[model samples]
Target: MNQNAEYSAVNDAVRGQFLRRTWAMITPYWRSEEKGRAWLLLAALIGLSLFSVAISVWINHWYKDFYNALEKKDTAAFWQLIGYFGAIAAVAILGAVYRLYLTQMLTIRWRAWLTEKHFARWLADKNYYQLEQGGYTDNPDQRISEDLNNFTSNTLGLGLGLLRNIVSLVSFSIILWGVSGSIEVFGFTIPGYMFWCALVYAGIGSWITHLIGRRLIGLSNQQQRFEADLRFSMVRVRENAESIALYNGVPNENQRLSARFGKVWRNFWDIMKVSKRLTFFTAGYEQIAIIFPFIVAAPRYFAGKIELGELMQINSAFGNVQGNFSWFISAYADLASWRATSDRLLSFHQAMSENEQRAPAIDVRPEGERLVVNDLGMDLADGRHLLTDADMTVEPGQRVMLSGRSGSGKSTLLRAMGHLWPAGHGSIRLPAARYLFLPQKPYLPIGTLKAALSYPQADSVYPPERYAQVLETCRLPHLVGRLDEANHWQRMLSPGEQQRLAFARALLFAPQWLYMDEATSAMDEEDEATLYQALIDELPGLSIVSVGHRSSLKRFHGRHVRIEGGRLQEQLVS
Candidate 1:
């Protein structure tokens, strides 16, 4: 990967479109139902932060009195100062503890709100399905699970830290000016010369820190993506463990996994290299800053222009001013990380917004008594036509079976009818009735059998007896007793058993219009025949549109249609 080019692209995006999208993502939460609580928490944190800075200012003055008492060897004055210091310390500690507690409370609340909102959009209007089919985005799972978390915590941390430093900078600059007095340099008398010295020192450090650490923004972004990809590859292996084992594909899987990790390792090495250079500069800069104040103030001290007390105060005040001014230098790494996280979240937000706004090629409406396809056309992502100007309609209570050559459009037609495919221009009007589609491989969510059986619906929607009856009718008597038992049903059951569970689901759901896309392919002819007969006897008025290759399916359907040469041709079903 060309890191420079990628860095440029991400940098350009962050500069141009980052803030608008970021604001859009952030503002909704504050304006949401939790606005009252959010603003209250924010106010408390800000107040506590300012309080902590005030305590620092108080401690700076104490340094003057405490040092003078020591210089005079006044035992009573020194003891009195020590007692005062204890009181100030107690107040400072109390403020610091509450500040941390409140910050955590607000971060979690904000994260939860943003996560729920993103989840809704991801699943809304079938956006998840559309995004997967179009391949318009990658690993939305990670974006939601990881990126939002990083964005929330970093944004709060950086924002509050900056605010605290700004206040500190203003507060300490005044103190440094008054105590350092005046200095004559090259026959020119300079006022607040020490403040100027501290400013220039921090200014140079901040500039150098940015120059060395800017690449980390892009590197961090790439690192996150590479890590997610590696994790996803391993997850795929686990999901398909049986298939991989049957083929003895361990070597190939291992090679693929290793290649993904190679990208992560190389990119992280680049991160370490840049970080090493940055660390060298920052560490040296901080060490020099510690003694730089004393070096600048020493001449006046030796000249008897100021007492030991004022000189010590000058050191304490100068440290605060310089540290506050160098906030950017100290936080450069965190700033880079925050910006990278912001860019990722911004891109994800934009992709979802675009999907929501774009006009789909195939317009599907739900406003009819029968399923209607009018001039329905479908195409591959490459623009190769799958089905062209095909018109078909199924009346209420009709059982129709559609068949075609593999890859000819059998499945695409079903997807278009279901409003999932958008690569082709057409219109499909679905009946205003409950409908369900069973794909070749049924999805059994990892949960209780009753929950999986009642998927897309709560388990409470059906009684216990109804679930048991449906399971028995679908020839899954074994599972009938295990409805309350939870397991990963997809991995635990055989393919044939999973299909049977899908039928049990359909029987439980009882949709008026049913569509099956090779849903029975995993079952034997006898089992498939038994299930079809059960459906016919159980739901006499249920309409089914099935796409399959088995001849046994023909006996259940009163009408047969075949797609040939990108068109639907009617067939006589004996």
Candidate 2:
């Protein structure tokens, strides 16, 4: 399908799902522990909105009396009407203030609730990891943070605005019908001519407005994506500043950022062009509408068929009715944005749901006393076999090393054994005990040195002395004094130091089974030997499975294996 066709399909699907899910998404919060506050706030908002509408109707009638008193030159009656206007204005202002405050309160609460809901789904069952690995969606961060905010606010704003307009339309249309009398056009006398005139006028404007601005929906969606891509590119630069600076990649990075921004810039120009055209038509439509009622009602007054008060009232009522009818025209831009945001959020939610429900390709279970693999097979995403019918087992407390040429799927095999690789079919039974997997580049969140060392666990899980001891044992004695200091430890520490920190983390956790995929590749032979020896000394029963090519690692493992031709071959290690 074409791009616009695909977008429309997705947009329709989202709208269908949104209608189905809106109640489901909102019902819970009202029925939740905070139901009392939720319902109370909702009722107050509704009450204030109804009161505001009532105020509009009252002022509509006030227009008639005030203008009649003015035309009659009655000072006392005019002052009385002036005092009445003050009362109406005060009540309208008070209702508006409280209505806005309540709307904001509900918006934030609803957004928070929905954000937590989406976050839970995104993080559950390693959905985040799978989404990233599969490249199933884009800019999930933008969807969760910004799109959700827009969704809640626009949903409320458009919904309440529609309700108010509909009520105003009905109330004013009735008043207009009663006041407009009749008009003779083409030998046909039409009753309630002003009401019909406003209806036809607004109907034509809405149709033309839609025709002129339909492209904006797609443009808005593209604009958001381009903006997000540009923002993500900058974030990547910030994250990899150290590496980029070392490579002197400022020019390259700038070019990449500029290209992404170029998309944003170009897409926004399309949006602006469309918006400018839409504004031209809508501005003319509204300006004409202002004079339309006066022209329609003036004929009756000039013929002395109605007083000035009645003519003014006719104009007021007609304006309200026409404005209500033009609601679609006024809100078209917001509708476009709202539709785009909903489409993104729905797609993100669908991706997570699909990932969660998909049948697992690898059957990894934690049931065996030893780590066992039986009739295991793995494939890359392109259907290329990496390993086939592989069977292996490691007894408790046994250390094994896997060696192979690059692209032999050694790391992929380790990932499958760790139950992370999804493109695999295997029955791998792991020991029902704590295990730790360390890759070459350990992840160190920016925080205190102590927290980085004890990551995937709280900093307080181990005693302070134990933390210091592990750091010193891992040859990181220099870091002992800086345990409590907070910094970007990943950038602050060298590659070797980060690997050492991973070993320190292993020591602190004391997992029974440890998997290392080139975990010590960054350190020299001497430092590697020292950390491996430290592990063996510190945790005597620790089962080590190391993937590396270094000859020095031979002394650390009891058994050695090689991956070749998609099979495991036992290698003799001295």
Candidate 3:
């Protein structure tokens, strides 16, 4: 083997390792609790798959007799064979239809189960939050939705197809062997092992096809990654298109997109090059298969030992065997992408599971009416300290405000209380994890204003009258009429309107403890003060812990706290 051949061997090793890891990520979903139904569906699918192969066997025989009828010039036999052909074709079509129906059922059921399992895992224990916080993976949305769909589809299709082809190979090999007779070479008669010759021929063809097409697996993987990245970039552009265009950075964005798409272009070129070689070999392989059986049986025909029908049957068997061997060549690109998608989904799921299972540093206990922050400390992911030796207390029905500059440990402190800031040290004893946390950018899920206000709870939880009252009190009277108009409220509303809506949500939910982190900054000072007044009036017994910069916003809070100088303290604002 030369250097290129050695490189090819190395590629095989790397591809094998990649596939093993990818498979490890894929196989567990079936053996899960839903495995009963999943397995039943798959078993049915496989049986149909094998049965389809049985049908193909009948078709192979049909082809043999049909062609032989043509060669013998018997009009009656030819006409009768036409009827046989039609009958077999009808059976093949029906088998194909039911096989497709069963396979689709399996695919949809598997995808639904996998999607639910993955979604649950991703949503559990605030794993989605941490993954974004720690920067472990990109495009969780894509991973959960697009990548999972592809994984379900390509994996099942390829696996079932492989199974059918293997059976076809085994079934047809015997037929090819029986039809091929001995040949004379240089006066020393070679043993009649026509089947052995076909086997050797297919073996070499498969090996060469794989050698040529092996790189396509990784290439296809890279292509998917680049394509996903490009899509993510475009989505980002669309989401922030207003900001980009406001700054007149269209040229810059164009350049950025151009750069990202350039990677796609280059990688696609490499794929084309590999696919070109694969096509060349597979094409030649197919053409040779057309004549290979005839050539092998020609000697017997010249010797007046075989009929034309026998030769045709031999050719049909050769076709089936060769087709079985060449399956890898046909599906090489799909296999590559399927493996890539599996790796992505596996890593995503593994990362989500790891985060979900991570032990919380700050243990929250619902003890008395007061929250005790016991020796609470937090660290940056890089091992730098953010909040150190922190301790704070807030009693039930108390209003506490926290003031901190940008990059201070204020938000980290909130995360610590929530048991999400895992890279931290400390214990935060709260009443329960039932507090309402309102961040700076409120998340308004897509729906009616009433539903957005009543998130995590059904819209029916609040009567239409109270919902309207809260919106009017929060200075969002304009949206009072649009309560039933469904749309993407997150994109449609301004920051101030969204912040006010967050306040309305907090008011509606009535959590015992409400944590507001710059939640009302977007509204004007008067409206902000009014919304705080509304909350105090509507929820007099609600405990409020706020993070805010405005001095005008502190009158509603009885106690003030701060996370600064790497410590937590009472600010004592008068």
- lDDT by candidate, in order shown: 0.90, 0.90, 0.81
Backbone steric clashes in candidate 2, count: 0
lDDT of 3 at 114: 76
Q: On residues 332-444, what C-alpha lDDT tens digit does candidate 1 reach at each position?
A: 99988888788777767666777899898888999879988999889897889999999999999999999999999999899888778878887899999998999999999
- In model 3, the Cα lDDT at residue 293 comes to 72
Against the hidden reference, what TM-scores do the models get? 0.97, 0.95, 0.92
Clashing pairs in 1: none
The alpha-carbon RMSD values of the candidates against the true structure, listed in the order shown, are 1.8, 2.2, 4.3
| Better model by lDDT: candidate 2 vs candidate 3 | 2
Q: On residues 1-574, what C-alpha lDDT tens digit does candidate 3 reach at each position? A: 3323433444454455766766666677788887898888888888888888888788777776777778878799899988887887788788789889888888887788778877888887778888888766667888878888898899889999999999998988877776776666788765536666777788888789888987876677567767888999998998887789889998999999999899999999999999888888888888988998788778888788877777778778877887787787678778878866876665565566667677776676567778888887788878898888887888888999888888988877777766678876668887764678899999988888789999979999988998888888888889889989899888898899899999999888888889888888788998899988988998878898888888997898999887778987787768
Clashing pairs in 3: 182-192
